[model samples]
Target: MIVTIDGPAGAGKSSAARSLANRLGFRFLDTGAMYRAVVFAALEQGVELTDADALEQVAAQLRIELGDQSVLVNDQDVTRAIRTQAITSATRYAADHPGIRALLVDQQRAAAAGHECVTEGRDQGSVVFPDAECKVFLTASERTRGERRYHDLIARGEQVTLEEVLEKQRERDERDTTRAVGALIQSSDAVVLNTDGMSPDEVVDRLYEIVQQRRVAK
Candidate 1:
């Protein structure tokens, strides 16, 4: 069985999916980290974010591995490194490239083949696993999402102003929605969940309930 959660950044898709997977005894796949891994590689290679050809080349040659809760890139443990602001900022560029999306989507599919997995990303429901047993599109008010991101960065000891974070969030939102390849969108069959006032536990509960219903129906 595959459960896919698709949403914009700061919507708690990652945390919710991880928790949901654990509760359901399924593997967890964080697809956003794959793009972040590419961004990290680009930075290391001095490849400009706007250089789609170069970025595609870098992605083709890059080796990214996702484990239980960690990520490895080029034989190095960069589980934490790829979450930096720099990689976050450049990830949109990498995700916008068709070549990179095709490659990474294949990797994601291969990783989840023959396993019960909860996968989350901007396009997981629409593109990566449209046939998933459960597909959820999570969303929240921009203000709430921005605040969540701001607090998360501060907690990580990153100096980020709320205003700056909000601005970046808006920029990312625009890019994600307008990007040509695998742009963030809610699949028609996906159950849309507004998470503005919901806790992670609440989200997981609702998702589990949905899963139970599906299982009973089957």
Candidate 2:
């Protein structure tokens, strides 16, 4: 069985999905990290983010591995490297390329071939795993999301102002929703959950209940 969680950044999708997967003893796939990996590879190769052909070439030959809780590229652990500001800024550009998206989607599908996995990303439900058994779309107000991101960055020792964080968040939201390939969108059959005021545990419990109910119905 596959459960897909789609949401914008800072909406608790990653935490919720990971927790849900652990609760059910299923593997977790963080698709966003795949895009980040592509950006990281492109940067290493001196490829411009907007150069679609070059970016696609880099993505096609890229070697990315997703472990239990870590990500590796070309046998090198890049769990922390890909989270840099440089890579984060370029990720949307790389992910928007249709050629790159095609290659990465195939790899993502292959990764989940036989296992029970919970995949989370902007396009997991709408594009990567449209036929997943359970599709959930988590959402929250922009202010709330920005606050979460601001705190997260502060925790990481990144000196960033709340205004700066909010500006970046807005830019990301626009890019994600307007991108040509696999644009961020809620699946038609998805269950939308507004998480503006919900705790992580509460969100996880609700999702767990929904999954169980779906399984029982099946």
Look at candidate 2 and tell me the lDDT of residue 53: 88
Q: Per-residue lDDT for 1-218 in model 1, tens only?
A: 99899988899988888888889999999999999999998988899889989999999998888776789988999987888776788788888888999999999999999999999999898999989888889889999999998998888889989999999999999999999889898999888889878988998999898878777866
lDDT of 2 by residue, 7-32 (tens): 88779888899899999999899888
Measured against the true structure, the TM-scores of the candidates, in listed sequence, are 0.95, 0.95
For model 1 the local lDDT of residue 118 reads 92
The alpha-carbon lDDT assigned to residue 122 of candidate 2 equals: 89
Error of 2 at 99 (Å): 0.4
Model 1 lowest lDDT segment of ten: 209-218
